[model samples]
Structures are given as C-alpha cells and as structure tokens.
Target: MEAVFSKEIQSGLDQARVASMKKSSRLRVCADGKKQTVLRMWKTGFAMEADAPDMRGMVDLYDGSIHLFRCLVVTTAEESGERHYEFKRATAVRGTPALDFETPEHAPAGLIEDAR
Candidate 1:
C-alpha cells in the first residue's frame, strides 16, 4: 500500500532535510561544456546527480556563474548511490585583467620583466 503524507508533514520533512544538510553553496560543475548542478560538496570532493555526464578526469567548478577552480578528479559510485568525484588536485583560478594604465615615459624604469 502507498502511504501518503499531509502537506504540513511533508513540508516539515523537507525543512528537516534541508536543515540537516551541510551549509548550502552556490557551487556547480561544468565539464565538456555541459553544466550540472552540484548535489553535494566538500573540501576534497563533491557529488553530482548520478545521471550526470560520464565525463570525468578534469572539471571546472563554478560558483553560480563565476569560475572558481580547475580540479583533477576521479569518480566512484558511493554507498549512498550517488556519483561521487574525489579531487586529486584543485587549483584556484583568478581573473586578472591587463593593467589599463601605462607608466609615462618619464617614469623611472622598473625592471626588464615589467617591460615585457
């Protein structure tokens, strides 16, 4: 027999599940140009839906829309039945725009590397 829960009971359970979860993050995964929602995440690893792309090895992590990291990862089917990925290496990426202003010719020379 199928059991049903009242709206209030269901809502309570939903709220409980959310409350029991780790701190929510805007983190997401992008691989082979396909983006997938991050189901769960941790310092060393993260999980995406099991139906996510079979592509693995290298993945780019994003916070909502901003690029955050490049990770070398390996996949495993966790006991929880989720497609889990463990990070073998994670490197932070930063966007640095070229300096818009150029030093005046009168400015004292800094270094040969700076001229390059």
Candidate 2:
C-alpha cells in the first residue's frame, strides 16, 4: 500500500553502526472480521551478521489521521532476554483500497543494501 506518511531513523556510526536503523510508514488496510475499531502493531528486523549492521521496521495500524503519537519501549523476554524497541511518529489514517503490494518508489536508496 502507498504510505500516506513515512519516516526513518538511523543510529550508530557508519553503515555498520547504522545497521540497527529503522523505517516506519503509515498506510490504510482493509478491515476483516467483526470489531471495526481495531489496532495492530508488528515489527520486522534483520538477522545479526559478523560486522554487519542489523536493521528493523515497525508497522502499526489503526483508524484515524496519520502521524499522531509515537514512542519507544524496552522489554525483556523470558527466554531470549532483553530487547530494544523503536518506533516512528504517531500516525493514524482512515480509508482502505485494495492492498498495493508494489514497492514504494519513494523508499530510501540503498535501503536493501544497507540491510545486508
């Protein structure tokens, strides 16, 4: 789907250091099942590699305008241990069209390479 609003965050030093960077976007998706008022959040990240930067992205879905409230959190896993979480600006948007599976043209350059 096309992003109504998008933002990205980069951390660390060089590409290696910036490997843990994140990118987030706000988009509208179809609603299924009963409850119309629903909110969903999900995260995606890369695998760690020797001397490679690890990156991740978080996606949140709700009903309303875009770019509303955003925050980060730290949590511990009972089995895996502690983990760091980061998010983009608070964003909410309404309306839905057929899911656009096409890659966004406005995506940052070298995003794929940097994730490697």
Candidate 3:
C-alpha cells in the first residue's frame, strides 16, 4: 500500500530523514567507513541504504567504534531497493584472540615418573 502526502509534509519528512541519517547512521563501508547507513549485511556481502555511492572494490565494514571486517567487494544486486555488494575477500576483524590457559595441554612424563 502507498500513501500520498502534501508537499509541505513531504518536505518536512525529507528534512527529518536527512537529520536522522546524520544522527543515526552508525554503519560505514569504506576503509573503516561506508558512504551511508548500512541497511543489511552478511558473511559475504552487504546492502546500503538506497542511492548509495556508485562504488565497488575494497571496503571496511564498521559499526560505531567497532571494526567489523575488511573485504574486497563488488556491486552484486539490489535488495528491497537497497544496493548490494558481494565480498570477494572478507576477513573478520573480531579483535584480538584470547587464550584462557587453565592448564598446559601436555605435561612431561618426568613429572609423573616420580609419582604413582
């Protein structure tokens, strides 16, 4: 279903959208940035809000202060009117790894030799 709005109302709504985009657009798709808000993402690709940059190639997916991934991407298709890209090479940037060493994996036999 579609609803029509008066020109004044539509203009106001457009202004609001611009404001919302500035304040709430937390996702970016450049090298640690995207041109605009990312509407959807996946393991191998992502979709940005309508009329996204006419761009392709390497980009980084970031949400707020967190880095998501570094990927080589190309425009693929559109989903629900949003532009989509496929990741040719997507490497996860999930922060550093942690090793919770409760104990050593292999103990020397000499340690047990003196014991029962």
| Predicted model with the maximum lDDT | 1
lDDT-best of 1 and 3: 1
lDDT of 3 by residue, 1-116 (tens): 99999988886776566556546667777643435567656777876655677557778777876888877888887544567888899888966676576545786646535565
Candidates 1 and 2 compared by TM-score, better number: 1
Ranking by TM-score, best first?
1, 3, 2
Compute each candidate's TM-score over C-alphas: 0.58, 0.17, 0.55
What is the alpha-carbon lDDT of model 1 when measured against the actual structure?
0.74
Q: Could you tell me the lDDT of residue 83 within candidate 2?
A: 31
User: Per-residue lDDT of 23-108 in model 2, one digit per residue for the tens?
Assistant: 22222222232111211235621111233222233334333545323322222221111132334443433355456687698977
Q: Against the true structure, candidate 2 has what lDDT? A: 0.31
User: In model 3, how large is the Cα lDDT of residue 33?
Assistant: 45
Q: How does each model score on lDDT? A: 0.74, 0.31, 0.70
Tell me the TM-score of model 1: 0.58
Give the alpha carbon lDDT tens digit for every residue of 1-116 in model 1. 99799988876775555444324657788888777777678898987655565556888999888999999988866533347888999998879856789868798666566565
Clashing pairs in 1: none
**Model 1 stretches with alpha carbons more than 4 Å out:** 1-25, 97-116
What is the Cα root-mean-square deviation between model 1 and the actual structure? 9.7
Query: Which of 1 and 2 is ahead in lDDT?
Result: 1
